[model samples]
Target: MKKLVFVFAFFLCLAISAQDNYYTMYSFVVEPQNEATVYKLVEDYYSKNKPEGIYVRLFENHFKAEDMKATHSIVFLGTQEAVGNMYAGGGNVNFDLFITKLNQYIKDGAGSAMGKHIALNGDTSTRYPFQVYLLLDVADPDKYDAEHQKFHSKHNPPGMLVNMGNVIAGQGTGHYNRWAILGYKDMKSALGGPNQLLSGPALAARQKAWDAYRASNGGVEVVGSGMRVLLGAW
Candidate 1:
């Protein structure tokens, strides 16, 4: 079985940010033999602290870029206000303790990105626990965004949620400025099955549009692409 190749997905920029959801992701290296311990600590922390309208997920990175310097990523999502104030004026003893404990299992921190939710298609739920993320360097933001919406609305699967965003504040962004996240029911679905994958005219049209997009704006580069398993969400 082969996963659907995450190619030519037009992950647009600020002009497409109509959704209020914002997200931040921390890329970190895990201490050897402490993966479970790290996850448990985070799970315990979120389970107790209990913030409103905030979502958190731990992702085990697979086939990630060599330069990433991380085996896992912690992603936090919420309304702009909630996310911006997630750690604001923190004075809680428990929260401070949680951080202290968490740091022990983390070997090193690589980078992080804060972005706005640009567009969303299909369903949004935990049912789709697997994801594919393509970090892209977008040139013509509006053009790609328009084409992306039109293409996915007609060709995407039932539960396939496609989320795109522009990176507002990012550490180690390198050359990429946007991200396209695709969700699936499970690893098998994410990796694909016996049936033919994305074939036929739909794929062709998308490729053609992508080629044109590249021609006009120097070129669009996929900075990196990889799969992630969702470990926890809250």
Candidate 2:
């Protein structure tokens, strides 16, 4: 418990920000044949046992790594404390039964990441179909936040969300503990996001802006990047 609080405080990007936006993401593998059944099991369970104040979504990974066996991930959103408490005990017996039922379809636990939402900006009414996740090694949070905010303030994307958060647990802890996500209206927008920005009308200016976004913040390292597709949400 002591370590948990400390990690949250350190990783909860921008400590001044609210803690109500913490998120927990878990990944699992499903056989191609059992994919639909797994989703149906989750949908039916969540539909019946509505956990108050929690919002859940299922994401199908557009896998980049060849060996990454995880096919889908589930994300839970709510206040940090509430989410922590909820997952800490599986919420209740019904949820436990739900998990047990769902586990039969999943091959294994792929991975997971739970942490504070350092910053979140954009529309929430619709969970975009495509999400790009950047695994980063943020050397300086203060500097990174400065340039991140400055760049976005000048040119925020339409119908897009830019989110930066810390990874309190899961893969690459202490190495790449941060992630920046770009949510797009669809796969087309996401695929063309960078090319469209840098290749169109204002190529020079856009290139300069993009360069600055990368150079600043002590040259933040992007360890990896991958996209995710929406499966089910409720």
Candidate 3:
């Protein structure tokens, strides 16, 4: 009886500790009219107070879906304590401070950052319903620029890449710990849409591509992970 009770207590403790890693996602819709100004602000923020959560990623668009200039910018924050400390520290402490510092540092930069907090929505009761992917591709420098430019011409996202080069792009927000492999079906659903444009047989083909992608050293893959969607129509 004591052993069973001890095991239960241990699991309960783990569950509680796990909650500490909760991440808050902030998404923005940048105005194209202020694209230049917004881009400047992004660079300024990245320079002054380097926050690891800020990730610039590419989300390809498919038929029936809208594509724009920039894909999306993501910020991966650690546990609540990580965020709390950021705000509590004051100067250069929180995001607001980062903005203020940027504004002042710039010679004649007039632009502001706007964002909305995304809370946990949908069925939380289900264990890991959504799939999270953290992909890192080799810095082809040239290819990166081309693909990003193509992604831009195709999709008009609200964010911009103030500075681009041979660098590491970190992309993941919310529920960082979970799945490590991208399920081929889900990727197709997101990219191709439910109609299965890849074709019935192509479904297996996509998995093959994913497997090949994983095998290649060009990209790092994290699958089965779950995250709360902050923006877009879901």
Candidate 4:
């Protein structure tokens, strides 16, 4: 009875921890005339006044999607509250100047989404130069998440960051339940190919795991996957 209670408590703690780690992303296309100005302003602002507990990364979309266009910029926020505060004209240092420049230089419209981290692997501190965004339609979120976590644990690659998040609110396709961010060191590394983390026997093992996961769940469908180049980060 005591052992079972301890195991339950351990898993409960993990669930709470996961909930505490939140991410918010805003995607928008830069106006043709203001592209240079927008980039300079963002770089200058973040360099001077870095936000507390927030790791900011700016990405430019590399691949074209049916719904999304190239040159789209994605701002990744480390905290959920940061999203609300950022748009509410509060919290961020130099908010007035930042908002003013952003409004002046960028498009008026943007897409936003908030999600909590389910699983993560590799170095989270160092900023990578490129990222692969995987938008998925999950049939069984819980089971799919478990398999994803297991896969990363077994075949995690060095210098590669893999993180999965469950979308709770905001824009993009309503069918996408979860998204995964795969960070790579450089453009060359990113373009090298898929399943870079798994090799030899590990690759086989991962395939088997995926097969089992698919069999159990109705089957996972990938809505869209795109690569993005890092523009600037702080």
> Backbone collision count in every prediction?
0, 0, 15, 0
lDDT of 2: 0.72
TM-score against native, each model: 0.79, 0.82, 0.30, 0.78
Candidate 4 per-residue lDDT, tens place, 100-187, comes to 6676656544466656777888887877778888888888888888778776776666778887888766646547888888888887
- Please provide the root mean square deviation of candidate 2 (C-alpha atoms, Å): 5.2
Candidate 3 lDDT (Cα, whole model)?
0.32
2 against 3, candidate with superior lDDT: 2
What local distance difference test score does each model get? 0.70, 0.72, 0.32, 0.67
Q: Give the per-residue lDDT digits (tens) of candidate 3, residues 32-63.
A: 45435645665555565553333232111121
Q: Please list the residue runs of candidate 4 whose C-alpha ends up more than 4 Å from where it truly belongs after superposition.
A: 1-15, 74-76, 79-93, 194-199, 216-218
Best to worst by lDDT, what's the order?
A: 2, 1, 4, 3
lDDT of 2 at 180: 91
The candidate with the higher TM-score, 1 or 4, is 1
Clashing pairs in 2: none
Show the lowest summed lDDT stretch of 10 residues, model 2: 1-10
User: Model 4, poorest ten-residue lDDT window?
Assistant: 1-10
